[model samples]
Target: MKDRGHVSTTQTLDLNDAGKIIDAGIAEAERIGNPSNIAGVDAGGCLLAFARMDDAWRGSVDIAISKAWTARAFDVETKALAKLAQPGADFYGIHASNDGKVMIFAGGVPIKEGETVIGAVGVSGGTGKQDQGVAEAAAQAFARG
Candidate 1:
């Protein structure tokens, strides 16, 4: 018998799997010709691995990681959060206090396994749509396994 709210579940991505996710993100970025910065983080919002492609903006590396952290911590697309942060929103300044580490943009997505969110992926240095596309590709790669 399990206690209510204490159900045991398995982790979607282990340390080894996290490495695979990073590799998938890199490959997807190359495929898209974006060559941007990509980052993957665990449920705890800790960075698992990251990469900055050639010609990528140096600052995008940090931005990608921050976006991943925000998505994982909040369990929603960073872009959606950005929408809520628009002028006159009740939580506008809330997302801004992360010290430039929380990017509420369209480049972050939560990694999920059968309805359980286990991590998040973020990409930057490209257009907002391009970033989201790359992140989605990476997430799909993980999901296929």
Candidate 2:
């Protein structure tokens, strides 16, 4: 049999990784004295793990999920999309084009290993910067572990 030199295999984010991410987000949220919804999604934009803190905004659950989905699906931090989607920008109206599932604001970060994005973490219920802070904490913790 002729041996193939190499095969491409996609990296996956399992439950444990998701838990670590959630833990980090929780710690940050507690430190900030706020409750928020956190989301973890696989490279394919499917939810792997999720958590909504007590008293988190009831309206932000779907937004949190959409943030992670947007990050994983586009391999771009959702906050960055805000600028890209501005009028006259290359990706203008991109959010509306995605069936309104995309969230063009802070709180979504693509988790990457090397050059490959394995997953993403999203946070909601606080200010945009606050949400981003918690999400960044989650991504950093996941990367370290």
Candidate 3:
């Protein structure tokens, strides 16, 4: 019988990892002067940890969760997904799907282990660019550790 390769191990994030991501995001958001809501999700697209900075917009909490879920669900940066989800694009109207849990905008970044997406980080409460910057920093910190 022919042998198959060993089953690949899955990468998962724990609460500690989530804390790291959230801390990095908070740091970036503070530096940018954009108090923000940040979220982290595990490989299964389940919420792991979340943080809302003081004075952050209350409305952004849901946005942050949705963004994280969307990133892990689709395994792509939401900023890049925004383009695909644009009118006349492949993913047009996607935001209207997923029971409205899809956030087709910046601020969501998938955390990867090699070529595999293990989790995601999301931020909200500022301009799209500011949120995106915070999310990226959060994910990068996880990637480095």
lDDT of each: 0.82, 0.92, 0.94
- Candidate 3 lDDT by residue in tens digits, 12-118: 88899999999999999989899999999999999999999999999999999999999999998999999999889999999989799999999999999889898
Candidate 2 local distance difference test against the native: 0.92
What does the lDDT come to for candidate 3? 0.94
In model 3, what is the error at residue 35, expressed in angstroms? 0.3
Candidate 2 ranges beyond 4 A from true positions:
1-7
Q: After aligning candidate 2 to the native by TM-score, how far in Å is the CA of 7 from where it should be?
A: 6.0
What's the TM-score of each model vs. the native?
0.85, 0.93, 0.93
For model 1, residues 27-111, the per-residue Cα lDDT tens digits are: 8778888888888888788888888889989989888999889888788888788887778986677665867677878888899
Which has the greatest lDDT?
3
Each candidate: how many clashes? 0, 0, 0
By summed lDDT, the worst window of 10 consecutive residues in model 2 runs over 1-10
Question: Candidate 2, TM-score vs. the true structure?
Answer: 0.93
Q: For candidate 1, list the clashing residue pairs, or say none.
A: none
TM-score computed on alpha carbons, candidate 1: 0.85
Note each model's CA RMSD in angstroms. 3.0, 1.9, 3.0
Better of 1 and 3 by lDDT: 3
Q: List the residue pairs that clash in candidate 2.
A: none
